[model samples]
Target: MAVSFLSTVPNLLPIVPVNASITSAPRYPTLGATVRCSKIEADADNEERFKRRSILTCFGATVGLELVRSSGTFVEMAEAADLIQRRQRSEFQSSIKDTLYKAIKENPDVIPSLLTLALNDIMTYDKASKTGGPNGSIRLSSEISRPENKGLVGALNLVEEAKKEIDSNSKGGPISYSDLIQYAAQSAIKQTFLASAIRKCGGNVEKGNLLYTAYGSNGQWGLFERNFGRADTQEPDPEGRVPQWDKASVQEMKDKFSAVGFGPRQLAVMSAFLGPDQTATETLLATDPEVLPWVQKYQRSRETVSETDYEVDLITTLTKLSGLGQQINYEAYTYPVKKVDFSKLKL
Candidate 1:
């Protein structure tokens, strides 16, 4: 395991891979045109937006991680993740931006709170699934009031207030809290991304130039381009009934993360991935000391001058997770990934 990681990770640094195939592939530009990267390239000024949505490609993967644990089939997980992400409230993104920006400015001292808010809503408890003889009608706070949700108090408060504001000002009714949860994570990622880009580009990227970001394992790993038609009218998720985390072991973590389709390799990568960036993993490390080494590896790999391991696992995991998103897409669409022949093409 160590060798696989040590060897594979070093070569994968800088995350973003060049999709040279797309560029080199045969294609027409326009009338009497051959090909140029500009023909298919998106404008650089819009890079931030692309990064936001592309980061969102992880939405399905993250939500799906929980479903697979409860005996979920790939298609079932795909359906559920697709449904949840489709309904995400864009309003929550604003709050997320604020929270993550604060984290960037303040650093680890404030990271615990931000990470707590970002991760609390995503514990995989569903509202609609809370059915029994004695249970009352599921109100908005049903799951939010649960013991499992203790970590999410701040996130819940934020959403509750945001919902009320939206209801008061917007033409439409308030957005669903479930959707808002997904958006919170989305916003955090976007803010972190923009901040990182700014710092790397000398605090000011030119009007048209590359935004420094690793594309991860496979190029387009985090890019989800398909549309999801699942409606927002569906019921919220039922509460997730998971075991307590106290005294949990590394093997236990492996078993649990495996349910979400992650293997030791992924855990290895994710440890190095989530550990350094989010700093929220500190909450987990406090309870699960076994992951300390992996987290340390992530730190060294990311910050060390060697450049051998810098951000390798992060990019690798993102790319792999993007592939997982595509896998879910494949199942949800119930169609094969369409193969394109560049040789024969019109417009």
Candidate 2:
């Protein structure tokens, strides 16, 4: 989807389909562009994009895997939500969706511009190093200009599109743009996990069957849910909120996340995902030579180590960074889903 905007306007980005999953949710009766909300059929092509939010986002109408995986659109989303309401799925799995609804019903105004940083896994970060700059600075215009954030404009503009549609259709009550954007992201994560669960067990996808996420080395987390209610901020986030990968060393990244209640292992997990996915393997080495080291060890380990063992280790550490046991909900900050190897899918 594309939005035409005057060229002279600064900081106003044109809404384009940067990430496919975040397509237009369309206003009530009319069909918007075939944005993420478009009612699409599920198939193999969709599966490749549907599986992971750490890199890209894809949208589809149904939820299933023929030979692989695919995404879920409003239709499948409604079905899964209905199933969850009937207790077939855990309430925890629907936290993201629930939060969006709650945000719209309560403080609808904060919906737009609130979900900017919700997608920490977006691979738009540039390799530019900035150790010399302040860590948590929120210079809006300058922030967007940073090399690390080069490709993020597309998602940024999407915030406006989601806001426009949801607010217009808000007769049931308006929804802020941020709510829809956050919903789209969280929706992708929930659907991908649930889709994989259905692929494995061949039953209704819900907390009952999707509780495969292990918490501690010996214990397991019943489900993954993200909290909501992030209010929109007038300025960009402070510089230090996200890791300064281009400038900071691995230890710095660990320290930064650790300062906010995360640990080194979780930092490692986040680092593994920051690899430039848009850069192909042929060019990945040269595109960002530094990234390979962080993920290389894990990928190489995948070759010799048991895939389950490696994955379990990653998930266990990820529990900390991804809010494994934290008491977060729609009224609080949500956990970020670190990338997991989707290749292990049974399908």
Candidate 3:
């Protein structure tokens, strides 16, 4: 028998009330011990080693038990297990992406909120301290209640609804809140691009999907999709980690962006996430000497029907944003399946 890690887990975490507030919270905890934010950086070599170790570990524990009693050879069983994991992960990816697309399409109002939720979740990183980034701490009531995260509870609730559907269909276990939030944002952005194409085509859904699919760069979204297995933070992040978006000055916004290694071009391209109106945001940001040129450049790209330049930049930025301070579990979505076909055996 293959080792089954499948177990009944709760579909969603218990949500804290949106109105809950925790004043006087520290921005980052200092419990007389250093927290290593960069300790688990994901790299190519590290990922390869992790995958190899996981496969070998699982294979060792199960092969002996099955090899003695079963007809399947060790190589065949191991290959079957690896194949099952890959197939399951790919199917889950498609399933969850479909769920997100349906959720966003049926209720287009959630797009801005979803983008903001994802943005707030990621912006908590302080590169100087190397702490906090897209860990889903924003799901905590205390984190979302902050001034910067105002009007975001709706987005969180929407994600919770999607989570229920996703977890119900998941064979492994519940999807992590951290992964869901970032992925929902990615889906929302793609939907936004689709919406633009649909509008240009006068609400022709078929043509819009085809046109965008043909014109859109799958490589960009693929970059974001390849990253998974983000764990959630139990405690709310330290206060003041996110910027007060509605009230922050242009320079203040610039400083925050710089802290995360973003430049004027990124800031200009991501203006839609900063506010409801991308054009208005560009107009406001145009006042900044450093940001004006990029804003103007993207505005010109917007003149084209496809807005390909803007779409490419947004996808690239979002892909990077979703991974800030992340330590991915390359095997998170891989679940077990029947290793041997006993029914085929001639008894």
Candidate 4:
């Protein structure tokens, strides 16, 4: 039966035709038919893709190596730049300090005026709108001529002269009037501290200065001085902001101080800036029930040798007042100057 079945098959045959159609559908079930390419064409296409991928890989490796090499130098360069900036700032501040120190020595009368300039300028700050502050706007002719800012022109002139000299000596750009005004106030406060010590030392200026330095809070001025680089406003601030010291009532004074975010204690601590005498200021402010206690406390503290409470509060309050509505310029003293090499020049 097996031999008969084999004979009936006639002959053994290949499963596939010799000349199969290239466009024929797949024998098994498929989603779609496909176009078949010749072996040579497929090989060429793959070679082209490999060439592009190799080129891209080489380019990427070269860039990555460069970045890795440069990363080591970037930090060092940044540190060096920062050092230069700090050094320049220090030198700039020292120059100004020296010039002002000599100028102040020549004219000690300007001390009171200095504090007045800062006080009136800072008093223009309105907490609600955040419009004004110690921005040297008090230097304007219109502003200075106002009743609230009377007698400030002399102080303005003193700083203006210093500005001229400072500008001439500056390696960086000129110092703004805003920075000068606030810095002068800080210097004035230091002078006052020194003056007090000097008076205690039998009117010997040098001895007084030495004694004051030994009091251990001589550096309190740093609280105000460290926040440097203030900007000036071109136009004058609106009127009715500052207190009219000549005629302002106690309630009016309290109200004005309240507008600028100060309490009775702050008002009492800052009495010296309002007028020449703290005792007289306390007497006038003592009429108010709310402000009387602070006035009395500072008055008592003023009698002590150190006057620690008064000085500490004054410095802290003045620092806050000076910073009101100010946007500090971090690059104020970091200008890079080019030096001329005379030896290399032909002329």
Best by lDDT: 3
Model 3 C-alpha lDDT versus the unseen true structure: 0.77
User: Compared with the true structure, what per-residue lDDT tens digits does model 1 show for residues 230-258?
Assistant: 12323434554322233345566566556
Compared with the true structure, all predictions reach lDDT values of: 0.38, 0.38, 0.77, 0.73
Each candidate's number of clashing pairs is: 12, 20, 1, 0
Kindly state the number of residue pairs that clash in model 4.
Answer: 0
Model 4 stretches with alpha carbons more than 4 Å out: 1-72, 337-347
**In model 3, which runs have C-alpha deviations exceeding 4 angstroms?**
1-83, 341-347
lDDT of 2: 0.38
Go through the candidates in order and give the C-alpha RMSD of each one to the true structure.
24.0, 29.7, 22.2, 16.9
The candidates, ranked best first by TM-score, are: 3, 4, 1, 2
Please give the distance, in angstroms, between residue 7's alpha carbon in candidate 4 and its true position after superposition: 73
Clashing pairs in 4: none
- Model 3, TM vs. native: 0.75
TM-score, every prediction: 0.40, 0.36, 0.75, 0.74
TM-score of 1: 0.40
Residue 98 lDDT (model 4): 77
* lDDT (tens digit, per residue) of candidate 3 on 57-145: 43444444334535446668788778877678778889999999998888899788898899999999878887799999999988888
**How do all the candidates rank in terms of lDDT, highest first?**
3, 4, 1, 2
How far residue 198's Cα lies from its native spot in candidate 2, in Å, is 11
The prediction achieving the highest TM-score against the true structure is 3
For candidate 1, the per-residue lDDT at 49 reads 40
